[model samples]
Target chain A: MRIPLVASLAWQDYRNDAWLSACSVLALVAVIAPLLVLFGLKFGLVSSLTERLETDPATREIIPLGGGRFSSAFIEQLGQRPDVAFAIPRTRQIAATAQVGTLVLEMLPTAPGDPLLGGLPVPQGLEQIVLSHTAAEKLAARPGDWLETRFARQVAGRVEARDTRLQVLAVLPLEAFARDGLFAGLGLLEAAEDYRDGRAVLALGWDGEAAGVGEQRVYPAFRLYARGLNDVEPLRVFFARQNMLVSTQALSIAQVQSLSRNLSIVFWIIAGLALAGAFAAIFAGALAAVARKRRELSVLRLLGFSTGALLLFVVLQALYSAGFAAVFSAGLYGLAEAGLNQLFVQVPGEHASHLLAHHYGLALVAVLGVSAVAAACGGWRVARIQASEGIRDV
Target chain B: MLNLSAVHKSRGAGSQRYSLVIPALHLRAGEQVAIVGPSGCGKSTLLDLLALVLAPDQVGRFEFNQQDIAGLWRADQQSTLARLRSQHLGYVLQTGGLLGFLDVRGNIALSRQLLGLKDDGSVARLADQLEISDQLGKKPSALSVGQRQRVSCARALAHAPQLVLADEPTASLDPLNAERVMHALLAQAREHRAACVIATHDEPLARASGLQVRRIHCRRDSDGGVTATLGEAG
Candidate 1:
C-alpha cells in the first residue's frame, strides 16, 4: 500500500481513539520529559564545572618544597622541563610586612604570569609592586604610586631593619589572591632577603653599601606551573622523583571530575529506568490497540490489504504518538533548562548553565528508537492476523 | 471468469473431521451466483476457498480469468495471490465489516488505496447510485443495519474488482431492505461487468435475485464426521 494511505488510515485510527491516543502520548511524554531533564541537568552541571576548570589556571599550578636556595640557574632549569610551563623562585618568609606610611600589610614576592595574579598586570622593574584590592584601598594607591616598606631581621636576638621604596604597577581583584597581601618583584624580595639575613645595602636605604655584593642569592622555594591540568600530575611526579615535595589542586580537580562522572552514571541509570517504563507503556498500549482493532484489521485484510500494509498502519499509529511525545518532551526540556538557568546561576557573575545541542539530538534519537521498536512489536502481531477472521464476525 | 473443479477441503482428521467437495463450478463475467445452504454446510468455507483465503487439500482445476491457480498455497504464492486479490477481488461481509475508524467514503475507497489505484469517481458514483451519497461522511456506527448493508454493497463494487464475494450480505436485514440491497448489489455487479458470488441460507431471496443457484448438502455420519457435497448448478 502507499505510504500516504497508511498514514491517513493511522491518523484516522488515532482520531477515532482519542482518549487512548492521548493517554499513550501523555505516558510517553511523562517518560521522556524526566529523562531529558536529567540529561540537561547532567550536561549543564558538568559543562559548568569543566568550564570553570578550564578557565582557572590554578588548577595546574604546582609548588615544590625544600628546594634550598634556588638560584636563577635552577629556576631556568625547572622552566626547561617539557611539562613545566614556567618556574619562578619564591621566598619562604610567608608573612613579610610592607608599610605604606601608616598602612602595613603582609607582603610576598610575585613572578610574571603567576596564576594567583589572574590577569592582573605583573610588576616589571626593580622598584615596581602589585597590591591586592584591599591593600590598594588601605594604602590609597593606584598604578604609578610609590610606596615605602620596612623589612626587619633578628640578628643574635636583636632586631635590625632596612626600608625600601617601590612604585605600584597595578591593583588586582580581591579574588585573585588568597588574602590581602602586597606583591613586589624579585629585586624587592632579594632586598628583603638581604635585610632579613642582616645584610645592609646603601642603594636600598640601608646604613651602608652591601658587603655581599658578589654572593649568589638563592631562593628557599619555587612556584611552578604546568602547561595544562593533565601535565600537573607529571610535573608533581617529576618533583617527587627528585626527592622534592610538591602541591597542586590536581587532587581536588580529580575529585570534582570523578564526582560529576558518578553523578552522571546515576542520572543515566534513572533515565534508563524511566525509558524502559516508557517503552513498556507504549508497547502495552500498542498491543491493546491491536486487540481492540482486530475486527478493523481483519476487514482491511478482507479488503485485500497485504500484511505489510496492515503492519505499516499499526506502526504509523505508534510513530505518531512517539513523534508527538518527542516534541512535547523537547518543549518541556527547553522550559526546564530556562527555568533552572534562571533559578540557579552556576558561576558567579556569569550564566553558565545550559543543555548542549548534541545532547538534545541524542535524546531525540533514543526516544524515537524506543518508540519504533515498541510499535514494531505490535505491528508484528497485526501482520499475523488473517483475513478469514473477518468472516467469523459475519 | 471463475471456475473450480474437483476441489476438496477438510477440517480436523479421521473420525472427527468435516470435509467439502465441489465437483465443478464455473461463472462468467456479469454472472451472479448464489450458494445456498443450511448452517454448518461449508458454504462460508467454499466462499473462503474461492476468495483464495483458504487452502484446499486438492483441486483438479481452479482458474480465474483463464489462469490455472489451483493449489497455490505456498508462502510465496500466497503473497502473489494476495496481490491479485487486492487488484481483482472485492468482498462484503455479513456485518458490513467497515472499519470503525473510517467514514463510509473512506471504507469504499480503502480497497483502491490498498491496490495503489487512484479513485476515478467510482466511489462517488457508486455512493450516488446506492443512495448513500448523503451518508458518505458518516461512520458505520451512525448507519442503520440496512443502510450499512447498502454502503457495504457500494464499497464492494467501488474498487471495480473483476469479482465480488459477499457472505450473507442481507442475512440480518428485513425482507424489504434485503431485497433492496440484493437488487443494488446485482445491478452494480452487472453494470461493472464483474461476476458476483453470494453465500446465504435465505433460499427464497437467493432464488428471487434471478441468479444461478448452487445448493450445498451436508450430513453428519454415525462416526461424527460431516461430508458436504455441492449440488449441480441450476
Candidate 2:
C-alpha cells in the first residue's frame, strides 16, 4: 500500500475502534495532565517566591557588621560592583542616630538609583530628607514639612546640643522601610559625624573646630543594597574577602532556592515514572491493535503493502493517540490551572499556578517523540508479519 | 508470461508434515487455467506459489516477464518479490479479504492506489462491469457474501495486473452466486489480458467456466508425511 493509503487506513481503523482509541488517548492524558500541573505549580511557586525576594528592599539589604575605616575612593569602587545596587558611605552608628519630635530616626545616606527610594528623587542637600512612613508618622511630618533634628557632640570639655531643621523631601512607603529612618544626601550624614567628632561642619557653618585639620573625608562603614537576593550571598562573600564582615538575608534566599531545586527533582522523578507508564501503554496499545488486525494487515501486505508501509500504518495510529492526548492534556491542564489559580490566588485573575506557551509546546513534542518510539517498537512486530499468513488465513 | 518447473513447498514438520510439488506449468497473457482437486489436496498452495507469496523450496526454473524469478527467490529479494506481487500480480481469496474500514470503491481502488496510479476510472468501470455500481458506496460488511466475492474480483483486476490468482473465490457463495462470481472473475481477467489461475475443488464448475483444468493428487509418504503434486489432470 502507498503511504497515503496506509495513513488513511490507519485513520479509518482508528475511527472504527473509536472507543478503544479514546481510551488510549485518555490513558496518555492521565499521564500528561498531572505532570503538567505539577510542573506548573513548581514553576509558579518558585517564580513568585523568587520575585518576592527580588523585589523586597529588606532582602536586598547588606549591612556592615561593625564600623571600619573605609576611604571615599574605596566607597566609590564599592558602588561600581555589579552586585551592589546602591552603596554610600555611612557614619558611625553612634552619630547615625538623631532625635526628631518624639522619634529617634537613623540617618541613612542615599544616592541615585537607590532601590529603597523606589524611584523617588534623592534628597539634594543637607536640609532635604526622605522620611520612612513610621518616622513620618512619629514626627507627624509630610513632604515640605520642616522638622528640628538634634544631635549632641562633646566639644573640648563641653557636651553641646546642636539643632538643624530639615525639610521632608518625600515619604517612603512601608515596603521600602518599616522602621523609624530618614534618607538623606551624603553631606548631612558627614556633617553630623564631623560635629560628633568635634570637627567643624563647614558646609553648615555650625562650627566648633575646622574640618581642614589636615584630614580627608573618610567613613567607617557603608550602607549597601544588593542588586537582588542572588547577589546577597556573593556580596557578603566579597566583603569578607576584603576583611570587612557584612550581614544579609542569605538564609532566606537559600531556603527559597533550595525549595525550587528540590521541587524540580521531585517533579522530574514523578514525570519520569509517568512517562514510562505512558510509553508502555502506547506500546501495548500499538501492539494489540496490530495483533487484532493481523489478518487485515496481512491482506494489505499480500496486496503489496511493504513491511515499511505496514509499520507506517501501525505507527500512525499510535501517533494520532499521542497527538490528540497532548492537545487534550493541555486543555485539561488549563482547566486545572484555572481552578488552582482561583483556589490559591490572593486576588481574582492573579493566578499562582501557570505554564508558559512553550511549556505546552514542549509537552506536545515530547509526547509525540515518546509515542513514535513506542509505536515503532510495536511496528517492529508488524514489520515481521508474513504476507503468506494473510493469503492462507483469508 | 510465466513458466515454472520443479516448484516445491512444504508445511509443518515431522509427523504432521505436508508437502506440495508443482513439476511444470506454462502460461501466456490472457491464458486461463484452473487447479481442480479435493479439499485436502494442494490447489491453494499452487496458486500461492504462482502468486510469488509462497517461495518454492527448490525450483529448476521459474521465469516471469523474462525475469529470473527463481534467482530472485534464491537471492532472498523480498522487496523485489513484493514489488512483483503489487505491480504484476493479483489475488482473490475465498473470504474476499476486504478491509472492513474501506467501502467497495475504496476496496477496488486500493490496488491502483498502491502503484500511485491516478484514478483512470477503472474503479468505476470495474464496479459497473461487476454489476456492483449500486454497492460502491457500501462497506464490505454491508455486502452479501456473493457481493463481497465480486468486490474482491474487482479489486484484483482493477490494477490490470499481468497475472490474476484466485483461491476458492466462490467457496462461500451459493451455486448461482458462485457461477456469477467465477464468470465475472474470468471475464475481467480476460478483458484485462491477464494470465489467470483459479484454485477450486469443483472440477465440473471449472470445466463449465471454460478454464483449462489442472489437478493435484496427494499420497501418504513413508515418513508420516503427505506429498501433493500438481500438473495435468489425473
Candidate 3:
C-alpha cells in the first residue's frame, strides 16, 4: 500500500482508540513536565547568582596585602596579565596621603579602563583629580571645582609644605568606593614620590636636586583589578605563589561555584531517572499494544498491507503520541515556571525558573528519538502474523 | 484470472492431520465459482492457498494473472505477494472483519485507497445497490449481521479488483438474511466485472445462486489422515 493509505490507517487507529492515546500521552507528560521545571530552576538560580557577582566591581578587584618595591617594569608586566583589567603604580602609603581643602585623603593612582571608576571620567591631566564619593562629601566638593592638593616634605632638615592647584574631574559613585580617597594620574603620584625624595619635580617644579624622572622608576606597590569574578581567585593565587598575597572576594565566588555544581548534579540525576521511567513506560505500552491489537494487524495484513507498511503504521502512532506529549509537557512546564518565578519574587535578579526555545526543542527531539526506537521494537512482532489468520476459522 | 492444475496443502500432524488437494480450477474475469463442502473439508484452506497466504505442499502448475505463483511461493517473495494481493485481490470474511476504528464508509474506502485509486463513485453506487446506503455512516458494531455482510460486500467490490474471496460471507445471519446477503454479494461482484471465489458448506445455495460449484470430496488417507479434493461437478 502507498504511504498515505498506510499513514491514514495508522492515524485512524490512533484517533479511534482515544482513551488509550490519552492515557499514554498523560503518562509521558507526567515525566516530562517535572524534568523541564527542574532544569529551569537549576539554570535560573545559578545564572542569577553568577550575574549578581559578575555585575559588581568589588568582586573583580584584587589589591596587594603589603607595600613593597614594585618597579615600573613589574607594574607594566602585571598589567600584561590576561586576567588583569586595570593596573597602575602606587606610591608608599605615607607619601600617598595628601590634603585637599583641609581634608586629608589617600591618593590612589588611576588610568583609563579602571573598573572602580565604573565608566567615570579618568584624571589624565597632571593638574586634574577624581575624588571618591566619601571624600567629595567630606570636602564639600564637586566636579569642575578647584582645590589645592597639598603635600608635606622634609627639605634640607626643615619641614616644608608644597601645594598644587588641581581641578576635580569627577566623583566616583558611592557603590564604587565607600572610603575617603582621591584618584589621580600616575604622574601626580610619581611627582609626589619625587618631591618627598627631595628631587626636582618638573611637573610641580619644587626646589630640589635635578634628577631624570624616567631613570629606573620603582614604585612601592601597584593597584590591580581582575577582569571578572572568575579571574579574581586565579589571579590572587597566582600572586600568592610569588609570596605576594592579593586581596579578593574569592570566598563568595567559590560558594556560588559550588552551589551551581551541586544544583546541576541534582538536576541531572532527577532528569536521568525521569527519562528512564518514561522509556520503560512507553516501551512496555507499545509492546503490549502490539499484542492486544493482533487482530487488527492481521486484518491489515489481509488487506494487503506489507509487513514494512504495518511497521510504519505502528511507528507513526508512537511519533504522534510523543509529539503531543512534548507540546503538552512544555505547556505544563510554562505554567509551573510562572509559579516558581512568583514564589521567588523576593530574591534579586533574573526569574527563578526559565528556559529557552532550543531547550524545549532538544527535549522534543530526545523524546521522539526514544519513542521511535521503542515503537520499532514492538513493530517487529507484528510482522510474524500471517495474512490468513483473519479468516482461518471464521 | 487464475489457473491451477494441482495444488496440495496440509494442516496439523499425526492423528489430527488433514489435507486439501485442488486437482484443477480455472477462472476468467466476471466469473463466479464456489468451493462448496461440509465443515472440516479444508474449504478455507483451499481459499488461503489461492489467496497466497498459504504455500502449497505440492504443485503441478499454479499461475495467477499469468505470473508463476508457485514459483513466487517457493522463492518466499512475501513482499511481492503482498503487492499482488493489494493491487489485484479483495476479501470478504464471514464476521464482516470490518476494522472497528473505521466507520462503514472508511471500511468500504479502504480497498480502493489501498490500490491508490481515486474515488470513482462506485462506493456510493455499491452501497446503493447493496441497500446499505443509509447505514454507511454507522460502524460495523452498530449494524445488524445482514447489514454488516452487505458492507463487507461493498468493500470487496468497491475497487473492482481482479478477484474477490468470500469466506462464509453469510455464516452469521438468519436464513432469510443469508439468502439476501448471498444474492447481494454475488450481484455486486458481477457488477464490478470481477471473478469471485466463495467458500461455503451450502451446496444447494451455491447451485440456487447459479455459481459453478467445485465441491470437495473427502475420505480417509492411508496415513490415518483425512484428504479432501476439489474438482468440477456436473
Candidate 1 lDDT, A1-394, residue by residue in tens? 5788878998998989999888888988988888777767776777677667767776777866554667889888987888887677776565356656777677667787677777778887567888889888877888898777666777889877666678888898776665667887766766666667667755566653456658776678876779776787777777789787878888977876787889889987898788778878778877887788888888777776678878888878888888888899889888887888889894564433456678778877887788888877856888777778754763
In model 1, the runs with Cα more than 4 Å from the true position are A38-57, A68-99, A102-114, A122-128, A148-167, A182-220, A226-235, A331-354, B14-16, B65-71, B76-78
Using DockQ as the measure, name the better of candidate 2 and candidate 3.
2
lDDT of 2 by residue, B57-159 (tens): 8888899888888888889887888899999988998899899989899999999988989999989999999999999999899999999989999999989
* Per-residue lDDT over A6-102 for candidate 2, one digit per residue giving the tens place of the 0 to 100 score: 8888898889889998999999999999999999999888887887887788898888887688888898887888888888888777888778855
Q: Comparing candidate 1 with candidate 2, which one achieves the higher TM-score?
A: 2
Give the whole-model CA lDDT for all candidates, comma-separated. Answer: 0.80, 0.87, 0.85
Candidate 3: tens digits of C-alpha lDDT, residues A1-394: 4888878888888998999999989998898888898889888888888988887778877878776778888888989989888788888878887887678899899898888887788897789899999999888888999988788899779998888898999999898889999899988887888889888787677878788656787677787888878888888889889999778899999999999999989988988888888878877887888877777788778878889888888888888899999999999999998899998956655878888889999999999998888888867788888877744433
Top lDDT: which candidate number? Answer: 2
The predictions' CA RMSDs to the true structure, in order, are 4.2, 2.4, 2.8
Clashing pairs in 2: A1-A305
Predicted candidate 3 versus true structure: per-residue lDDT over B1-234, tens digit per residue: 699987888888876889888888989998999888888788888888888888899999899999999999999999889888877888888788788888899899888888788888888888899998998888788998889889988888887788999998887888888899899888878877889999998888888999998888999977788989896865
For all candidates, state DockQ relative to the true structure.
0.57, 0.67, 0.63
* Among all candidates shown, the one with the greatest TM-score: 2
Provide the lDDT at B138 for model 1. Answer: 93
lDDT for A169 in candidate 2 is 90
